[model samples]
Target: MTDASSSLSSLIWADWPAPDHVKACVSTRIGGFSPAPYDSFNMGDHVGDSPANVVKNRARFLHLCRLKRVGQWLTQVHGTQVVEAKDDGKVREGDAVYSHEANLPCVVMTADCLPVLFTDEQGSVVAAAHAGWRGLASGVLEKTVATMGVAPSSVLAWMGPAIGRHQFEVGGEVRREFVEHHPATDQAFQPDYQSRGKYYADLYELARIRLGLIGVHQVFGGGFCTWKDERFYSFRREGTTGRMASMIWIKK
Candidate 1:
């Protein structure tokens, strides 16, 4: 059990050159109603956190963040599915979210996996995606930009905290899969010196290369290491852990 009150001041705000009406932020594991394992700040309701605690945490989150409406939360499955955001209180099943409506935030929750927030230069669109290695290899980011309904060149994406390169060791199969999809992914991976068939993959670099290939070159954020930094959650570091949330919306 820990202090129940928390503030958004410690949150990770997306630093980008997006239009004024566009707002984006990423949550860190800081303070909340949860106890122990889930600790104080856990945004993922599907992670065995108490429903009541989740409700209190999310409600307090909105109040503190001053969001007039609720964010669209999805049942992320590490897939490339992108869905238009809706705040109707129904849990949407997808790994990515997009929205054009004001105050309706597109949210994605993740632990270790990458969470990406997107918006257009004109602030007419916003989207978020949960990109793990599998999601990356399967084109979640590509589909996210496509679902935003904006030209890839106009999309400005910000990658939030994730498992960083140094700690994200992957098997050769993962490397080969990404390289097979795009040769540029090769540059994002470095062979593990101690392991014969493993590599330390740079998710940020991979994402940037993937986004660049689609004409979305102004990618930002992402030097964060969830496993190394105790401020964020990491499923790889802790088998039973909470998830941080990445969100974006157009302000009216």
Candidate 2:
């Protein structure tokens, strides 16, 4: 396996750097053996892609990394449920997984939805969460940070690639859900000009507000647009699409 510093041209896992003993990476839809819909580097098994091809892609991902296989994969129901990572077990069902153990990677898969990575100041614990609009509105980020057992102020969050605000148009009912939940949430959505009863939502800003409300001030990496970027897989752009992984772990 190539060391993180030695392989910077992977196209996918290049943006995130290994800093302060916490290793992290967000894979793009490049470099693998799947075909057509899955194309390459498709990590999701339930997306109707060929199992063997998915396995090959996963193996290739592992082969490129110095770390061992990731510990806990989640079913990702887009709910706020958070699970503790187990040393020995299959992936569990949930939107978030947290662990203090080193070398046990916590991973979240996404196409257009957000996959967020978290760690505390000392790097003892790390987590990953799948936050769709539903999950975001329902407090997935808050719950995931709380599961780490660190003060929210000491944690650092990294927002991975997601559907950009320009592409995330939603109806008034969706806006109503947030406003009803928190009257202040009205600021997150702006009226869409092309369609009535529809508004463009800024998910990143919404997440920032949610994280800030809970005191997690050290946040980073919210620039990529999965829907507009051809290099990354986007579910909104291609209804039947493969998934990319966002992973974080403390080094042993």
Candidate 3:
């Protein structure tokens, strides 16, 4: 890990309040080794990017900061499953990962889905979650917060790039899932007058409401709309697009 500041251009660092020991970043779609639809900095290997290119890009991503440990990458299922971070060099099957250990980054990959990074006021632990619409409706953020082994009130959350509400049209069923789980989320969805039985969904609002339900409320970082922003990879906007990596870890 040498001179990371120069590499900052390829990533969007989490803008949140946590101890200086916590390190987090979301890799953008600019500045990497992949080509075509996964051009340049595509951090997701599962999205049809060349395996070798993914390896090179990940190495570059890790060098963005001096974390000597491997990121706990996951085979995200878009569900509420949470995995404890382990640095065995194995990718696990879960939508979220958390760790109390320093240097061991908890990582999640996303395209249009919301990537969330979490930490406590004391920076005792950190976590990351891949929250697509399905995972959000199923309480993935709550699970990540609970798994961090800290008081919910002290948990701070930062949402990474995601599809904005205006570009995220949802059907009646999708809206029903969230509103049914948390009545407060109804306001997060606005009826699309142009399309009957359709509504514009806000992923950021829904996540904030869910975290609030569990007493975790120091939320931050939600102005990025991946679909419209070429800096990020959006699955909804481009069917064969790449994915971005959002990671968080204690850096003692």
Candidate 4:
């Protein structure tokens, strides 16, 4: 496998100790052809960016990553469904995707929501998940772990950029959803002093709790706050903005 550092100066590589065959990286809003608002490397076609520009940006991403296969992009509905990544070039409707096959990149687009990548220690499989508050509460990570067909203890996860705890304000419903499922998640939410019926949530902590529940203790990356970081796209920061992608694959 090629050294990721050579091709990925503008992106964030997952900092886990994944095997050499397991490749993963998260795209930034830099180095592409799109114009303002979506300004440059916008990877999500479903967003309002020009289709031609989106295509070009995707091409640039593939070339920069030195990936020979097409990314399996999903039509994420913020649900817990996890599907196997296939190279059919068709967009599947799900929040997470896993693949044991080499060269098929499992990818998820996100702006403010969390993008998570997963791999087993043996480098035999990789998966990606889009975890918004709804998806997180609905068990997306748990579903992804189960889909990988590996023991939870063997899985390593990396959390990508997202709206951070101090910036991500949530309603009572959001807090209730998590607390009802796992009371320990209550600590992940802090009361929003400015808003009465709202709280600031720690998405990274929530993800760690979920992964820990399934015995996945090796987690990394999560210091990113898309809203504050200009390098990443953020929906909450820009209402009509583009999306960045978190992708993973096994080198063929």
Off by over 4 Å in 4: 1-7
Q: Clash number for every model?
A: 0, 0, 0, 0
> What is the lDDT ranking, best to worst?
4, 3, 1, 2
* Residue 222, model 2, lDDT: 85
Cα TM-score per model: 0.96, 0.93, 0.96, 0.96
Q: What are the candidates' C-alpha RMSDs? A: 1.4, 2.9, 2.4, 3.1
Predicted candidate 1 versus true structure: per-residue lDDT over 1-252, tens digit per residue: 334355566578898898988888877777678886887678888889998987877776666667978879998888988998887888889999898899988889888888889988899989999999999999999999998888998989999999999999999999999998799889999999898999999999999999999999989999899999998999999999888888888888
How well does candidate 1 score on lDDT at residue 46?
83
Q: Is candidate 1 or candidate 2 better by TM-score?
A: 1
Best by lDDT: 4
lDDT tens per residue, model 2, 150-249: 9998888888999999999999988888888777778889999879889999888888888988999888888989999987899999999899988887
Candidate 3 residue pairs in backbone clash: none
lDDT of 4: 0.90
> What lDDT score belongs to each candidate, Candidate 1 first?
0.87, 0.83, 0.89, 0.90
What TM-score would candidate 2 get against the native? 0.93
Error of 2 at 185 (Å): 2.6
Clashing pairs in 4: none
